[model samples]
Target: MKKLITIPLLFFIVFPARAQSSSLEKRVSINISNQPLELALKMLEKEAEVHFSYNPRVLELDKNINYKAESRTLDHILNEILGPSISYKVHGTHIILQKAPKRDFYISGYVRDGESGQEIKNVSIYEPQTLASALTNTHGFYKIKLPVQQKDIDLKFSKKDYDLLIQPINNRSDQKLSVELQKTIKPKVLTAEVSAIKTPQVKLDTTPKIEERLSSNSKPQPVPVPEMEVKEKKVNIDLSEELAFIDTTYQKGKDHFLNWLMTTKQNLHFRNIQDSLYKPIQVSFLPFLGTNLRLGPVVTNDISVNIIAGYTGSVRKLEVGGVANFIRKDMTGVQAAGTLNLTGRSFAGVQAAGAANINLGTSSGIMAAGATNISVKDSKGLQAAGSLNVALSEIRGTQIAPFNYATRLNGLQIGVFNIAYDRTRNSLPIGFFSYVHKNGYRRLEFNASELNNTEISFKTGVPKFYNIFNTSFSYGRPNKPLAGVGYGLGTSWKYGERLGSNLDILSSVYFQEGEFSYLDQHYRASLGFEYKVFDRLAVFVAPTLNFYVGYDESLDFSSYKLLLSERTSRWLGENARTYTWLGYKFGLRLCNKS
Candidate 1:
């Protein structure tokens, strides 16, 4: 009987380890500043290099719009991508978009002296057609394509150093012309016999004979020619030829470094990491394989494009892989590590770890990990990732979760604040979002969440997916959490991924199907910050002030808004919002590729 019982327990235990474990994730981000509607549209259409449609007129809720662009969206995506690019006026329930200016297919050409055949180098060339333009090359050849509005058009040409040339074109002839550049004879040059006295280069245009002194003392050596130093005015002189600047050396250096990282895919281990934002830390290798392509601008002249691809998996641990810029911070109050952790990786944008770690004060980011850490935490850009921040204190915002932090609860999350009973409210069912950045802690996150009259809060700085919007809405039940009903929603605005503190205005009225006279409505406007406190932790605090306008007669919404925990270690998740008690929350969250 004992042997049979052991076999059954082993079967159930091993099954979960072999079953569903992880989900994959792809990410993209674009940042476009508030340029003019027309210009902004053109930039996105012509510069956003992604597989999406670039229709300024099309509006889809949560769909990928493949488009192509030439310029980089690096900075634009830093602070403004959480909302729509173009704002529209709402007509009742409908939204009316602003109309954009019309453009033309421009036509442009050059003007050279028909006789001397001398092409103007600094020539002004314009097309009445789309206003597109180009100057003539040294060979006098120019190329241009215009968005012309009308068939009959006019092309204008004028240069500060050259005469103005205007030509009219009709259906009569193929558009082309050549005008002579009459020599620009200047007034100064025409007047010859330039006396050295006025040249200014002559500090003392001295000719004792040229001046007849009336002074009695002729021997007094005429007022010592005050050696006037006419500080030479650096008149910017435009060189006659365009300079062919060479950057071959720098390019070669950058290429060599990147090539080494790509080609030399040997297992590498790094120890003793001291970064600006976080404390000291270490990372190992989890041998695996995958691929990654980071098509963002190399603001750091280090490299332009980053491509990391490989696979990683520990002998008795999870597999890890992914490509990204590795940024770390120094650890404070160091604690010695217990045993060796597998960090060997072989993929792009991914990582995995499994082992007991002892971190006294450390900051790090890991993915696909099953770590039993005594005090190890996951913070990106200085902010935590969940509503019930496990150990650390101080957090803000709503609806954020670190994919599997609540994995111990399966699909259900059950955790709370500090184990000690402080005036600060402890366990409440709140969710959080921590920000992940390019190099590491360049930015942080803010999030908020409440459900089934349980604890729910938000913080800035978190992660999202490839060109996807983000949003989450949940229902609250005060008394019974397990039996209570719940609903949640997540979405993205505009193109998503741009995260900075911008006033977010969201309105939703849902009469959730079922009993309980459910009409939930809220108006919350909070300032958010994506901060990088240290290498290991980035915290974002937005003291929010919101108003609950809509009515739910069957429920006292305010009570749930300020949920308090009876036991300092845990409480109902829905009470995160309706109940009021100075609560101290800390988050320890994790995210993998997904």
Candidate 2:
């Protein structure tokens, strides 16, 4: 039984191995004369017991071929019948025929200074169109490969402070090419004759030139020169343009302790140069100790992985850090951090962090944080945070947090407390309390209704939607009074400058005999017509529909002017009674226009 099992297992494994062996090793016998290449290949395929795959256009199947083979390896027979450009690969019993690619052409040599005849390191040699590049080693040697090209290919050599060099070569074969770079001309510094004399006062005629005059101007006679006052007047000069080529120094603004631990001054000097260089990948332990080394802050990378915190010029794809990530310029990709994320300029992708996200410039994507999110300039996306969200300038998206603030809001805000300083008509703030300082609606209303002798309500928010808090009181019998305090929402509309209408819905709990022994719930809806009497004052009258549910019959009904009364059935027990009424109210309102 053991021998039989072993034989079956061995047969199964051996058969698969043999079947998967290269089909090109199979022997074939064939003989054909004056046959088309297509027919010849078909004959060989049958003899070898293998399938052939090839592009007819590339294989020139119509070409005539005279071939004869006897018991020869399939590879040998095919090689003899095929041109040098055609190649083949075999898999099991199948064969794939393809046109062979041209050999890669290599350009390898040293880059040296033209004047000094010394090797230059770190010189960038690249093909502009393909972006195939190689950097010179310490010995100034570089080797780069280029694809097959019929025309002359141009390779560019660039280095900071050196003139860019482009060389063209038409050779298809590998070649050794060495070139020298020349230092660029120094920038021309402008010279200004600054004087220390504050008042050298020599008055002369103030008139346009005689030949260039558009209109005639009165010319004044010259006055005697006055004694000079030696007071220095400082003049500021901007060399941003002239010195831009050599200005690699980065702007290290207000310093923090992280600067000492994460970056070096020498690395900052290469920021300008590194800004022009693009790299595919960067791995860093910190800002100054990374794959790009001292130039980490100047280079934009496609994929960046930071063991701790990292600082880079920008990110084109994805960036992740164990602690935090700082970007010197704009980022156009997703960035994630364990603690915080800070971007210097605009950002246009998703940014998330464990602690906070701060953008010094505008942003236009989703930013989420555990603690807070802050945008210094305009923003146009969603900001969601655990604690707070703030936009110092303007926001055109949504903010969801415990506290949200913006200079101007053009979208929605949802939080515990929302504050927007600018009056934006399109903004909707939904929270426990929302305040718009400039053009928010606020009103103090004093009104009297048939059901209550005295009523006062305070409303605040935008005129489109606002919150209301009100209180009502009534004198029933001697020493027996009724009082209610409630909250509601209201909206208002204007017909013209001074005339408007409002709608409000409110609910309140009434207290009777200075005790909470019985439940008295009141519900009402009011529609009011208002007219402005002065700048900050208005008068209004409203028609109200009121509903009241009571449990105690001993509670006085003298204070209520009810139109209908009925005994309630089951919800609040046999003592419950329901009352409904139609009432009217007149009021004086002190409000700010919104």
Candidate 3:
């Protein structure tokens, strides 16, 4: 009985130890066919009953692996799957995979032109396998860090207008290489000659055949040869002569209006019986019945004086007309007309007209018109019109009119309404409504004020200044809602990259329900700070000082009250016509221009 007990105790102790050791040594059967490393590891984890511990970045979990194991030990299977670059460690019940650390070294260099020895900027130096790249700076310096591997690394250098360079680096030691790149050579043009030869003439004789009389060993007489003549000729060509002829024909065909002006001047002068002597001064009674009207189409050096009207092909000095003056070509001197002045082409002198001034081409002098001034192309001087001024192209000087418009404005436009298709740094449109297609600012705002609770506002102008139009409705404590309209001027000052301040002055009129005649007027000045959340969206908060003037004493003032009641009461008398108070406004802005 003692021997039986000893045997059972020995078996019990040995069996438990063997089972505990065999738990970790358990065989796992896993078959993963071309799956991601993460998924394959998960399959192994389920079969082997082991957890994986690793940093995902170091494990390269996205890499694919094809692993198959049948009744194999987990350690053996892991060694078969992971290559030398990766290592694994087995703990109590976990498998840890990690990437082998590598020693890295740097490569720095300069790239220069082989011919001129000048540094080349923006050269790309890259390694294709690693997807590592470095660009040369302005000083043509480049530095790149690479891992120390056993295989050779290929680096490629390339730039525009230069030949490509590929270099091989074999070691991990830091290196400083100066590389010179050759420029690509352009192909040169070569001239070749082609000769033309006329075919030789062959004559066939059909006369009676004569038998040859010659000895068998003697040579026959040589046939008579025909003389051949060759001739060579050189041709001379002048391109300028052909071009001049074409230009003259084009000019004559294009100047039909000029021809008419010349014909009219000659015919009118002949009818007036003017002397053949060249006279610089001539007076005309009417457009075609003038002293200078008989002058040739283009007056070279003549001062035209017209009592009522004048017509000329081209004016050189001065033209004065009582009613109107018309020129077909260009006018170089001062032209003044009682009614209107019109030029078909450019006008280079001062032009003053009582009614209107019209120039089809460019104008360079002061143009004053009682009604309107129109220039089809560019204008370079002061243009003052009573009604409107229109320049189809660029304007270099000031334009003063009730309405001014230009394609490109390089100067100031002072009018009630101004429009510029292109705006420059110096182009300023100071008016009620200034619309610049290029550099103007436009925004839609929703604001709140003491007098106007909810206001919808439209603001437009340049970056420096803008005009505001506001319409608000207050429905707070008043028995009937009050509606108000306001006009204001605002200026902005930028403080930071996304912060700005705005100063505005506004005057508004509020009208009560069923009473259109009686109105309350309020003047307000505000300073606001705007924070731009996006390129097109902004939020603003402002502190305002308001002066309210009540037209009706019985109207309720509760709708136009603010938080600073204690400070406002000190200035408000018992029976005061105007009262001042502090107010606050918060709003959002949607900008159409940057």
Candidate 4:
């Protein structure tokens, strides 16, 4: 990234506009920007069903604010957007989202002969919970994910070649077994001429016991008969063997080659985007990437806003803020913000930010970006500003800078562009801007950013679109006092995949105010990879080969210097990001370029 790294004007914030008075509203516009675009769009459908289920009517408000129409507030918008399909819990402004489906109980096993230990095929297993029934495969194995609770179970198994078998479990823990068949025995009839077959006979006599005879006049006592009990023929069990089966709820994670050394915050800060980006994707006649703070692959897309917001704590006095987006396709995007140390401590100073990006680009596409310093008050305690800039891009296509300056060259744009500056200043101030672009060939751009102080940088390149490599050259102008050119050459390579790689190498020569002066020189090489081995997400990695050379002419000696060039990248992996729903959160921020 050149010195003037901040993007000029961020893609404006667009949202749905509403009229305060209305009854029986079938629909309304939603203005969700700087929030999660992917997730928000999905949440809209669930929220819009106000006619009945989920109570959308309750989410909708019938009131006015500052003489405005009855409309939804940010809080209500969030509430409605969070519908019932997804289980979500909210604390303060942060939301916890979770999805719950009927739990699955998996049953898997093999079948074999009760005595021969031979694998059995076409064996059936059934569970009523899921109406799941399966036959053993060729390997005599069967598996199922169902809902089978603990209870005595009944299952019937029948094979054309074998006899029907009914297995009943008196207890849930009873192990299942197989059936064995034996050959039926045949009996021969006996001959009638068998010798000395004797027939025995028994005679019955009616008599009374000695005690009963004397008491014959009294009532006779009832006789006690033996008890009758019948039992099922129990299935044979090999008690020596221990049957093992365990029900569990563990899913197999997909295979992903992740380089743990690659963390998100550390990688997304790579190659700063120069301030001269153009917008080819837009809604209005104006040249814009998106309407307001919303951006997307097409005119209408969603967005996501996931960040922690807080004012300077009394103890820490920390002012922190960040905005995120799903600019390309999925919600996977980038972010940038600032923090002012308000702790009234030794380290208490306003911290400005210039970041590259925050997204894991696999869901949507590849991206490149940069953020400019927004700190109006510097470490030196200056109030006004040195300069402000912001330059962020998704993939390598159109840039969204409307205020930056550019020269319409064939492929090498030469002129001053824009710098992203922090607008939350101590007092109000005004400035001027310029911009130009042509959508042919490899792109070229230049930018000049700031207030009072100055910074300059330029980029010329063939966007490595459908092909593998992007060829290019870059130069960062010395800030003010040393206003000269610093030059470098490089290219990038990528294989589009969940797991992909990228490499770039470039060397630069810096010049001071004098044309023949050499202030610095260096070489930078980088390696990166992108992988999407998970659901609705992708991971990114960026590491670099860095070396720098510094010289001081005042000493009349040329010295070789070696310093490491820090490289950065991002993994903002979000999908279905809700930048703005067309019928809902879709409006434009009006800016007059004339």
| Candidate that would win on TM-score | 2
lDDT of 1 at 17: 46
Model 4: lDDT to the true structure: 0.31
Candidate closer to the true structure by TM-score (higher is better), 3 or 4 = 3
The per-model lDDT (C-alpha) reads 0.31, 0.80, 0.76, 0.31
lDDT tens digits by residue: candidate 4, 536-581: 2334444544443444232111121222222222213321111111
Instruction: Report the lDDT tens digits of candidate 3 across residue range 1-594.
Output: 999999999998887666545544779898889899899889888887878888887776887898777898776777677666777665556667888666677899999999999998877666644535567788989997777873678877777667778899987889997899999787887677667887999989875444533324566679999997877777878799888997677556545543454444243332322222234665777655654434433343358777887666577789898998877668888999999898877999899999999987789999999999999778999999999999988999999999999999998899988888887775777888877777776778998765567889887777676788888897744532388888988877778868888888988887777778656777889999999899889999999987776655555455555623322222233433556678888999997655
**RMSD of each candidate relative to the true structure:** 36.2, 17.1, 38.7, 39.6
- Find the 10 residues in a row with the least total lDDT in model 4: 577-586
lDDT per residue (tens digit) for residues 1-594 in model 2: 999999999998787667646577788778889999999998888888888999888888888998887888888888888977898776678788999878678989999999999998878776644545677888999998887864657887878888888899778788999999999899898799877878788889887686766464658669999998999989999888766643332223312322443443423333214225567888888776777555555577888888998877778889899998887777888999999888877898999999999887789999999999999779999999999999988999999999999999888899888888975787888876777877787889999987678889998777777888899888664322378898888889989889999999998887776579875788899999999998799999999988777765665443555575555555556556677778789989998856
- Please count the clashing residue pairs in each candidate, in the order shown: 143, 0, 3, 72
Error of 3 at 224 (Å): 77
Winning model by lDDT: 2
Per-residue lDDT of 1-594 in model 1, one digit per residue for the tens? Answer: 999999999998876544322100112233445444344433443433322223455433243333332333322331132134433333222223443343434344556764577775645455433333456666666654544445765655555544455666554333455556555456675556655565445476665553365444557555665678889789997753432232345445533443344312121111100111111111223212211111001101111111232211111122212332321112121112222122211111222223322222233332222333222222222222332222221121111224313211101212221121111122122233222222111111224344222222332222211111123333433422222221221222222332323333333333443644444544344443433334344444444434343233344444444443222111232221332222222222222221
Q: Worst ten-residue run, lDDT, model 2?
A: 249-258
From the highest TM-score down, the ranking of the candidates is 2, 3, 4, 1
Q: Of the pair 1 and 4, which is ahead by lDDT? A: 1
TM-score of each: 0.17, 0.56, 0.50, 0.18
